[model samples]
Each structure stands twice: as C-alpha cells, then as structure tokens.
Target: MGVCLVLIVLAWNVVRLWSTTAAVVMSVVAAVLPPIAAVVANWGEDH
Candidate 1:
C-alpha cells in the first residue's frame, strides 16, 4: 500500500515534469523500495 503510494507519486511527477532523469531515478526507487520496506516492516517478527 505504501509502495503503491510512492509509485503513484512518482508517476504523477514523471507526467507533470516529463523528465527522463526523474523518471529513471523514481523507477529505480519504485523498484527497490518494496522488498526493503517488507523486510524492515517484518524484521524479527518470527522470533
């Protein structure tokens, strides 16, 4: 859900600014954050 929000904002900015660099950077972040967020959110819960 949080990841979705980030992607949505990224899309909005990409569309609004039409900047390739911003798109690429946001795309990288959008790709990377979900797994990281999941790991952080679930860290140590199985103990």
Candidate 2:
C-alpha cells in the first residue's frame, strides 16, 4: 500500500515534469527500492 502510494506520487510528478531527468531518476528508484526494502526489512525475521 505504501509503495503504491509512493508510485502514484512519483508518477504524478513524472507527468507534471514530463521532460526532466530527475523524473527518470525517480522512476528508476521507485521501480527498484520497494523490493530491496522488503528484503532488507525482513532479513532477520525468519530466524
């Protein structure tokens, strides 16, 4: 849910900016961070 919300905000900014390099960078971060975060956040739970 949080990831979805962040994606929506990033998408809105990307649309608003429409041609900026930062939007591209943010889009990449939005694509990559969630899964990495999920792993890191859960890394010790199983033990």
Candidate 1 lDDT over 1-47, as tens digits, reads 67767775876665448776766766777778888888999999999
For candidate 2, the per-residue lDDT at 19 reads 57
For model 2, the local distance difference test gives: 0.71
Q: Distance from true position, residue 15, model 1, in Å?
A: 4.9
lDDT of each: 0.74, 0.71
For model 1, what is the alpha-carbon lDDT of residue 25? 68
- The parts of candidate 2 lying over 4 Å away from their true place are 1-4, 7-19
| TM-score for all models, in order of appearance | 0.56, 0.53
Best by lDDT: 1
> Cα RMSDs of all predictions?
2.9, 3.0
Name the candidate that leads on TM-score: 1
- lDDT (10s digit) by residue, model 2, range 27-47: 677778888888999999989
